[model samples]
Target chain A: MSESQQHHQSPGSPPASGLGLALFWVYVLLYIGFMGLVLVRPDLLSLRPFFGVNLAIVYGMGLIAAAFVLAVAYMVLRSGR
Target chain B: MLHETSIAAVTIFATFVLGVIGLSFFLGRKGQSASGYYAAHGQIHWFVNGIAFAGDYLSAASFLGICGMIAFSGYDGFLYSIGFLAGWVVALFVIAEPIKALGKFTFADALDSRFNSRGIKLSVAISTLVVSVFYLIPQMVGAGSLIKPLLGLPHEAGVILVGVTVTLIVVTAGMVSTTWVQFIKGSLLVFFCGVLTVLILGRGLAVNAGREGSENLTPQIRTVRPDGTVLVDGQPQSRDHDLRPVGTIIRLPERFAGQESTGPLGPLAYLATLEDSTIVTWATKKHADSEGVHTTYTPVERPGTELLKPGGFFKGLASGNLPDRLDFVSLMLALFCGTASLPHILIRYYTVKDAAAARKSTVVGIAVIGVFYVLTLYLGLGAMTSGALDPTDTNMAAPLLAKTFNETLFAIISAIAFTTVLGTVSGLIMAGSGAVAHDLVENVCGVRMTDHEKIRCGKLAAVGLGMVAMVLGILFRNFNVSFLVGWAFNIAASANLPALVMLLFWPRTTRQGIVAAVTVGMLASLTWILLSADTFEKVYGLSRDLALTPFSQPALITIPLGFLTLVVVSLLTPAPASLRR
Candidate 1:
């Protein structure tokens, strides 16, 4: 109900910065690689025997794990900055 | 609808609903300020806000739909999970901090933060409401499915129960209660699903010859007549005809040829072993006969290797045709782009204190959500082989899978699923209300109300949206359109994503461009879906061949249209005095 300003950022600079853009591109590429496999060479996704699991499952699980790790990496980068 | 009505289910359902309502009232006391009412005064802990992200995001579609999809189709079902989780990456990195830095209450706040365009407010607000409504229907429909088993109530009654309860929760507390409810529901859902997954792994994979009297491993065929009469094998079934509840392992892998069970297997081992087994999956055929609709469900046995392939469910990938392939890619694109574009999810950013908190919360959310998605693969596959699947209703897979284990697990799972509906529905209603009160009424309509007046209007909007959801839920109850939610994603991506991405990255985007892009993008996707072949066959009850569109999904066309519209419109029009940089 209140109309008062409560925005957190200093007014001048936008929030989408260099590091954020880098991370976004990284994720976009990873996703593209996965989807490309599904499209151009789906058989590649099914390529198997890594830890007794097929390549598709491993890759799928890897994407999830990698997202987590990358996010954690973002936190590290942000903190360091 | 898949389980027997038991005392435990009733007790658990009642207790959980009461507890949630109580929590709403308890949390409702503190958020009297406008920011407090809408965004929790940006005071919520980063961690709780993070988990609440999961609660808000994991709607019935995620829990029931994806699980059911995977249970029926194989590796493809998990693709939805990956697409869903991947969207969080965009949210975390690109949208999170900027969104947090920009908006005060609603998603529109951020978009209009720099430009202060009434046109932007009007278009974005309307888009928000439309997407929220489309998204709400599935949640309410899912609510009906959850309640039908626990209370032995009709589907309409279930929809009304959830509508009334969610409305009460939102009207009582606003975002304050919504956040806490989501956090609790999210934690409990993950915790319990993990427990269930453990139970599944412990049981291991076994070739269920058949349940007791149904020892014949061969498939059973049931034909549903146009007059809605049921025929089993070659004879009409008695009045109490059940679809012979199908799904079982017809044969084990060669490695376990003699053994009835493969003992205990690890997560990867379970999938590997199943790949070598032969399982009975159901196939359905529908045709018109004597002015009656006859649909046949035939169970077919297939090797695990085939089931694990992508084409099994998506059809497009399996067809190996170009247009079909494009449709599959478009759907994946929608799922990927849609999360960052959803109004309910976008509004969640305002709950945190600052850009840093918003970023941290998203990271936490991704971690929590990522782990949960992985769990869904196990849950879905476990249900697939649980041998207790209801071929008629895939949405019942998870709880029914619990039923196969024990009554207690079923009771707990059903109760959590009900809360799951409540958690998601509340968040959605909140987003809808904000679209109306804060964005539409206050900003676009030029109605300047005080904070107190705004809260009153938001509550009114919540009640109205709740009523709309209830009606749609009841109307769509018998509708077996599971992937219809893809419509919401497609529209959200095409309409909202273009404006947000351009606003953040492109410098010359005019207010007119933003407004036009949203309007055209939204209408384009909606019209395409309405004219799609799937809609012709499933929704309109007409021949699919008569459809207007080349394929069902519109993202591959409309997403680019949005960006292009913005570009062309921006170039032709001069910037408004307020917008010149």
Candidate 2:
């Protein structure tokens, strides 16, 4: 990639590495899946209703967790890059 | 009646306005070119732009509306905070890079990148104008609203004040001034809100034992039958009102279940009569009657003991009921998704250099915005039981809560609120100006204007948009300004999000598809709202039940329809190879 193009795509750019791409696509799928689950069957996700933890909460938390996990994994495996 | 016209408030407001104009003149030299005027030469620092984002994003809705909503509704209001921040995820992860790479002046540039189609330009421009105008109303109305309570001026005066000041700001230096103004407002708002939150925490919760000077007497209520005669139970009762008044105050204490609650703790609570408070009544009294009856109300007081425990609105929200929870979740979703897709917000990306800066700025913006939202929760809860709520106006809850502490804090916050209008409206007018100059005058009309001419035309458009916004500010004086903003978000998320997302990700997304989606999304949402029951009742003076849509909000349906239209239309169209990656 040219220097200008590289600058344009840095920071919050879509995943480019094979592993990164795989992880990104997985995260996307998880997001979609959990969202669908929330919309379709909110009760199946969790039993904690009193504390405001319903399907959307579960999915929201799940996505955050997944993102955290991916960030950690990327740091561990792709340090040299 | 209102303490808005104090010398301190007027002086602070005047100083802020003069400062904004001075800044514009200082920045005017740099904004001489179309590029500089409209896009700030794409050289604004990422961190600065990020804070500017907060400034631009946190309008009256964030400072006043959300705080008010939270003060009244508890955890439900915090839902708006989460939803608004969540929308940035889309901005960071999905939009920033592509929008930076593809667009030049306006969102239309990004949508029409693949094909140089006039149809796309015209359609997107119209959508931009529609969203900008809808968005403008709230900010202008907020300006007027704040002025009434802050400067002790008429609502019209506030609207005019903001309109003139912001037009000068925009016309003088365009985006450069708008960005800086927003940056300053954004920083001040966050800082002040932080101080208020700390104050609330330090003071802890205390029962504002009702007013001291008033002669203490039990409130009186009388039940009236369908006839003019007042009745209690089955018999006619000699009293002023029909219903029996409940005199005792309800108390809610702040509760710390886990480790998180560390603030000063005393009695804290929300007090409201069940039926009287919950039911929003419309007068059955006839028009043109010799003597007109005004709105009457019973007061609900909070006991000194409940100030330390968390119940009331929070308890109801945490009760996990479906309707309450859904209302909370849906509102949050709107706030979260709404920020990224807002037309005024999208234009800010153009004012920064490169996609990288845009993304980085969004991260920083989110951090600032997120922290402010956290502060809103504290501010709202603190105000809930501060015993300063105006039964007529909930928006004053937070500022009034500050007043309970000290007058200086009130003056500063109220002035900041006024500048908040200037900052957000300047940004809105800039977006509208871009739509008019770049999309309509240049591309759609085929006018070959020089960069100099374009900047001139943009300033003119800014003035025009500002005037229109001022009129709307006065007209929509009575409507819930925050609720109106929600409709704007729905329209923006529906109209702009699908087209922008599809254009970036799907190479097959033709110009025709882009135009169709935006036009449909904008029109569908706009028309739906116009014909909806809320508008029919509020705007058109008709029965709300006679309206078309089952509910007032259109996000759940129209947003998906927009995405669907984009996908389906894109599938049928072919793209040129060069335009495609």
Candidate 3:
């Protein structure tokens, strides 16, 4: 990279471009899977998977939880780098 | 439904508005510099910025709209909460650090950072303005909705009130005041919502909880005449004569059969219990007569299992048709991709100091936003059983739910909701004004400007955009706030996300590519929305059969179209000198 380009390099740890991309794709797959289920096999979402609540509520809430988990994991992984 | 103005609500609402304006004036001294006015001099703390992200994001759509949707339509409303929060994943993992490293003021600055192309600057700036205005419509409409019950003002008055107040806030201190307002609003919203959730849990669920007589057992009719006179059940609607509030639990689970109420259930238990119950939900049918438009809301008893499924609002999920299913998938994709691309959200990256702060703030934002979205389910369900729903306006679900508990709580929640509009509107106006002054005027138009001149130009743009927001808000008053926000998301995802993603990740992305992607993406999505069935039926007042587009949301098609346009154009043209390395 040129000196000017390097100047704009984000401070702190080295750029986690690969890690970010990997984490992002992981989320993309999960989100797309969600859409896939809703499209192809929506009946699966209504099954009582656990806790007496249906898969629809469980999976929906799980997506939100997964986002937070992945976000914290990214922060931790990047800081350790 | 007629809403009697409450003095307490008016007082609390005024205090909140005046407090926001007061904070703007107090912080006005710090925004003398262009950097300060536009980006808060990049001095905002990560923690404060994080909460402010919540404040800016959890607009009337998230609070009032989602809760109302859930109250009226069951789990479908929670789908919006999920889709909205999911978009932040893209923001945190993909856009956060790079956006911080590249952009100085507006989203255009980031796009034009590599190539000083006026084409890129102009296209991206205009895209930013379009998305901001689209986003502004919901907030302004939400403001109008709140004004009726809180101040007894007309919808237009509420829109004007919010427009004028937000313009003053943006003109006074720009991002500095905007950030603090968001932080305060965000904190209060989450805290009070938490309180309300606890109250709901404590009250628990009851069969016919607040019903007094046979009044709510039958269908209710609300009619609006051509001259704008409203009638309820063939009687003119006044404060004393209004449509009865609806929403009730009709039956309990077999385990709790013959029980009057289930007291103070746990969160998981609450959902599980509601899963087996029978609830009375309203289904509406509308017809136009010489008298005017008459909407009849009929009570329908639905099993809890059906209400907890995906097909209530997105009927395509249940219809099993190819086109309808594609439409549902397309809307979800748009919501997921749109958050990271929003101009108002993107500009916030510049408010903090570094890429690290940006990342940290995003993490903070995700945690706060995630918790609130989870709480939305409980709030919506509680409102569903609260038996205080305004069947005519689903947007009033949450506030009216609070009213069932006590008037004081209702007043406070409504005030918080009003500030929620102010915070979001100010952020949007700031983004719009920055695009106008910093990007279009200075960069694209080649207008030379001093720091003072730039700030002056930005303030003028804020006033202009605020007025536009009010006008559009008034025009689109009947739309569900969350549904309207879906249009904004689709446009943001289609127009901005492809260009931003390709520019950052792909090396061969030329200036011409960015310009082409933005313009094509924007125009395609806007044109598609204008011709879609929903717009034909809702906005144009024509039969949906006359619509051109097969689906309402265009992101699934247009987002890919944007990326393809950029790649093809980039390959066709010779590389820029900078990329020739």
Candidate 4:
């Protein structure tokens, strides 16, 4: 219980490197943007429909693409740093 | 289904199991101490811990159950994929670092951090054990399902096998072996599923018009009347009748409905469906036996395509209007929120070294999990058209689809399915053991036990929980593996997530508030599930239509209730003055 009191890095702290913060924000914005796209255009979200159930393929793919974009952003940001 | 177990499959299965046992023994050494046994001394490498996250998280539910659901249900099935993946986002951004920075052993440590209330420990520990056991049942049931088909053994033997192996894993090394085993299983699952998906895309979708229906076309029907006596055809069918056969699917002469590619669907084509055509779906009911249960069928015919995709199981959920959409949304919400909140999954974060590693590992876990989920669509669609669907047992759809491609592939997948059970069950046992030894015995009871005593107590607890899991697995042998998982996710999301999230983010969260929220949330949700019509008819042998809840899943009702309880209760009780520090 005593060990629990030690102040660790607050969960909201920037990553150790300055560039990690840039990359993190980039990812956050991209994801939020993708989610916005989904919200605005629900039609883009429905790929496979059987029995009126829209498969969230559009949503899943959008997320994956955003993930890749984030990865690339991290790499580029890190390289520049 | 009759293919003999080959040397390759046996070798792969045996090697994996033996390697797992060896890893257990190695990790099990330091685990002789209590901290080592329960939480791996809270010193695992971040990278290893991260992959183990993938391992521990991707249970039989992910691999067999979801894939089966997707293969049978079409787009609605993929909704689960998205929900589950979204949960990791919540975990990574919101929970990972905070959980690692604060807690040790059980989730109760983090919740009870401000006030060393015994009540918090007791309630959260009970919630942890209850959720862990609910989750463990499906893993054990899946093990039985996999083993019966894999080694030609009975369901009882499979359950016993998992129980024995998991108990040994827990009793011997605890979290150390559990983490490594999960790491291995997780890695192999992602890799192989990737390979299978590629193979599926390469093979492409073709109509096997030559296939003929079997003599009976018996359809393995279950008819549920107003009273829930499940009957096959006109007679009552016992769950022990696992030997039922389903109707054969013959593909009509048109192209595959959901394909974006000309040859076969690469990973991209599967996702590229909404660009052109609107997916059409309709539902029909078939009567089985003397019971009057209605089966929803998705007539998989695309608008212009002659080839029809037969959507089983959840086809009804897709076509219906607002109420149906709510059911879909509720299920997705449970999955998205549930992943971060599962007790078994959260404990794995402790197994890693520091907060940074936990975050990094979560990132890796998301990457790996995301890729695997994408592959599921390919696998499910492959099975749907491969003429290998068991309408009676959607859980077997993926493996049977693999068999349609190659017997050897089928063997490998089956063996992997068993390991899927192993990895998940081991993590669950680790969670349960920690709840008993770390939270209940040592923390609440204020036992002055040595490290050795702690480890010893945990081993005993593991044995007890494993036995309980074994019996439940055997008793509930006939339930669909995926359906049961919904219950697990609902309970975990309701009981645990609210408390964990509020404690981490809100400074005013009091010990009494946490305890009450957990107790009420857990009991209320469990009661709702049991009293619901789905449970009465499906689980307790009562009438589904006669039950109270419109739907079986409690996520829509219970998750919000849990959050509100925590908020309201915390507002009412001020934190203790000493606890402000």
**DockQ per candidate:** 0.48, 0.13, 0.46, 0.15
Q: Write the per-residue lDDT of candidate 3 for residues B1-581, one digit (tens) a residue.
A: 67777788888888999999999999999999999999999999999999999999999899989999999999999999989999999999888888888889989988888888999999999999999999999999999998887788889999999999999999999999999999999999999999999999888888887455533568889999999899999999987888878888988899887678888888888898999999998889999989999999999999999999899999988998777878888889899999999999999999988888889999999999999999999999999988888887878888888888988899999999999999999999999999999999999899999999999999999999999999999999998899999999999999999988888777788889999999999999999999999999999999999999999999999999999999999988888675666
Give stretches of model 3 more than 4 Å off.
Answer: A1-16, B213-215
Q: Global lDDT for candidate 1? A: 0.85
lDDT accuracy of residue B493 in candidate 2 = 80
TM-score, model 2 to reference: 0.80
Write down the worst ten-residue block by lDDT for model 4 chain A: A9-18
- Candidate 4, after superposition: displacement of residue B503 in Å? 1.5
- Model 1 spans with C-alpha error above 4 angstroms: A1-13, B1-3, B209-241, B478-482, B576-581
**Best of the two (1, 3) by lDDT:** 3
Score chain B of each candidate by TM-score: 0.96, 0.85, 0.99, 0.87
Query: For model 2, how big is the iRMS in angstroms?
Result: 9.0
Off by over 4 Å in 4: A1-6, A9-55, A64-81, B1-8, B209-265, B269-323, B578-581
lDDT of residue A58 for candidate 2 = 35
lDDT by residue for model 4 (B251-363), tens: 22234454333365545553342123323222346544443665644433443121112123443332544444455556666876788789998888787766656766777
Clashes of 2: 28
lDDT for residue A41 in candidate 1, whole number 0-100: 89
| TM values, all candidates | 0.95, 0.80, 0.97, 0.83
CAPRI grade of model 2: incorrect
The TM-score of predicted model 1 comes to: 0.95
Give a tens-digit lDDT track for model 2, residues B347-409.
898888776577667767867776787677678766765556554455666777777777778
- Interface RMSD over true interface Cα atoms for each candidate: 3.5, 9.0, 4.2, 7.7
